[model samples]
Target: MGRNTRKRRTPLATKIVAGAAALAVGGGGLVWANFYASAHEEHGGHNRTRSAAAQVATIDCPDVGQQIRDVPDRARGEVDGELATMDSQITDAYQRLATTRRAQAGDAQFVGNSILGPLKERRKVIIDRIQLEINRAGGRADDNLDELAGCQGRPADQMQNGGGQNGDGGDQNGGDGQNGGGGQNDDGQNGGGQNQDDNGNGVAGPVADDFIDINDVQPNSRNSRNGLAANGDGGSTGTFTTECGVNENNLFNSDNLIAAPGVDNGAHHTHDYVGNQDNDAFSSDQDLAAADTSCQNQGDKSTYYWPVLRLQDGTQEFDAGDQGGGAEGNIGKILKPAQAEIKFVGSRQGDVVAMPKFLRVITGDAKSFTNGDANANSSWSCSGFEDRQVTDKYPLCPEGSQVLRTINFQSCWDGQNIDSANHRDHMAFVQEDGSCANGFQAVPQLQIRLAYDIPAPTVENGQVQNPYAVDSFPEQLHKPITDHNDFINVMDEDLMNEVVDCINRGEDCQ
Candidate 1:
């Protein structure tokens, strides 16, 4: 199975255009050959397993431009509701824990590590409620494509029709076995039959007989990527062999192997674009798993139960109980809207806070009172404050109406800072475009109040009096970044390649 072939076959581009079925006539076995080759060897030395998303993605298809508008069209609205619930719940839980640990502000700890226990526990209680819609959006489409793969390409179907897998016993690329006579290279794709290079690598050759049939691709790409051609029924199942092959540069490397069918699509979504860490639910990549690295008790932990949204009106949305949103529950229609983000708790110095990525938008969805202790704040009191402040000065409201705050850029961080540090105080507001809206007397503070309460983990002597870095709070943070990025490189490459393969195959993918 590891035998790398330098055999010549057909041009892939031509085969794709001709249709998935055209290649299956005698190509079904070729598909299997590939599958069999990679069954072992670290996915048999290949990288990632192609997801249905890659198989169905259409990159430069002529018809893509024609149907651009109607694209998946599934509104992200429902997902927002779900996000809001998850964001705030986690925040509140953290705050609850943060209060008890208020004593230890000097110990270093990670925001992510603190929440691991709580988040996992909460997820167990009601994962369906919080992540249902988002997960559905992310994984359901992929699942459908798998089903389609089974029915579309492979000699399995030919065998059912009384035809043997061995079309005509020939060399690995000469043809299938049986029926012998060194077949005619059918569609004239080979122009002459399977050709081999001096090094025994199949570079430019005729397309293998197997290709996804037109009927294989799901008519509704959204209904699940179930493509008939993807399924190895009578379609071609060629052998997948990875051996030395050089790129256009002509720099040959013997170990440069040929990957398995759909392998690139699965593991290399970003090979040619992205990366993965699905089990954690919060982790999409290694760097994921919302964290606050500078908090006292510097452990790699996350403490929030579930990230949720808290409205200015005191109303809140969380996911920890019965999880059943379907298409319109926690996510579908939140009778009311709540601001949201992946919440964090526990501080080192001041009261200001920062959120990961684009979370500020969720928190600023609706405005309210400043100084009212986020837990004590209500959605209603936050009413007109959608544009107000949250710190000591410069609030949008008249004097005493509420506290004014700001989100100033940090000299040490990349995103807007909201940590209870020396520079920026509390975040004033969240702008519509994912920017902090803390109107101010100075530069706009770039921090975000992304959490309600996050309890600091454990402490040695005792809880540090202040966690925020005020003159009183000292920076005790110390530890190495445990989550290394290297582990995900292969996975990332696999995901990207999957996307590219889908495009080349002319499937409707993201």
Candidate 2:
């Protein structure tokens, strides 16, 4: 089926301006780096450039949720709630930093004194509560949690200089000269940061420098576990395709049932859901099992969702004034996917077993911009250029090609638990040789492919118009690297067995 070309929302020619300066503060330390703004000539003075160390683009806090190694099952709920609160606290602090450009420029210690300081204190309280919960539940909370409380004002340029991997200058974005546009890419991602001329547009970024022409990128090779191509013919090669309409029912929310189950707006960004009908932050296992589904097979009531992609053409969505929408900096018209493909396929090494019911898996990192690409697994490309994928940058497709976002869930699973303290420990990707390490068992991997018919954004004279970005936390700045997907297996035993059978037998089944 072809994408609907009719315009759902008209594109607007919006313009953005740049700021004169930027500030940065390192986490747990009082380090400041100012960005060199445009130079000016004083009265009878030479054109003196404003010297600066670097530009602090956003707040970089330790992901406390991912660091906690142990939490008793009884206390998991309380700990999760407190962790979600920490996320909200950071969002609040980031909002202050992003909006108070004038004040930040005036006071050298404004960010430290007013924003980060208060944020750290609030986080400390939350951490204390979290520690108490764990200790009360007989689980020893790590003493190191205190170290994760303080956050730094990370420099935008330093992030790009690090090449989208670890902040230690690792090349997770594929550093080969053919695709590595570190210099140009840096300008693209931070160009808008440097040009924080307005409060409205810069709040959600993919500035002119954040996108590159798809043609300019080289086709990179990707291999799945078991030493086979992602779709290679091998041991367990069959697939089960579930037809879930492209969110036609309009199921949307900002709550994350897997990571922050009971916390409202835990994601802090609107998500488009296409599988289970009754999914929200407060949903329980019984609730999901009994709920209706959008999938073609009623037995397959699994939940699948991701951040809604939006066009920055100045359209005010229904949530425009709401917390996870415009108010938190995610403004623009939401674009329903023209195509949403959900499939579960077998591992390359051998037949797969049924995934534990209610198994939750999250692929990619929503905070990859500040958290680094350790868990980032975003694949962005255009229709015709599917061979080329970029993890950190959005692709600028040529005419006639639609934008595509692909997410492959972790393919290996620990034999026991369906959930974990960090929500990720139970799941693991296959090792380099395509085999599960540490006694982990292989399960059918879920893959989601979504295509969007968005008007390609254009960059002219260092300014972008009609840029498209996924809805994200305010501090993330809407970078494509932050694109992610989530899934929860709720398939009944009979259907799950069928899926496993099909994959192991090398038969494509629906």
Question: What number of clashing residue pairs does each candidate have, in the order they appear?
Answer: 168, 8
Q: Per-residue lDDT of 276-327 in model 2, one digit per residue for the tens?
A: 9888777789988999899999999999999999887667677665567666
Error of 2 at 71 (Å): 0.6
At residue 22, candidate 1 shows an lDDT of: 12
For model 1, residues 359-443, the per-residue Cα lDDT tens digits are 2111210111111122111111122243322221111122223221111122112244322111113223222222223332111
Superposing all C-alpha atoms, what RMSD in Å does each candidate have to the true structure?
Answer: 31.8, 10.7
Candidate 2's TM-score: 0.83
Q: Candidate 1 deviates by what RMSD? A: 31.8
lDDT of each: 0.19, 0.70
Name the top TM-score candidate.
Answer: 2
Q: Give me the overall lDDT of model 2.
A: 0.70
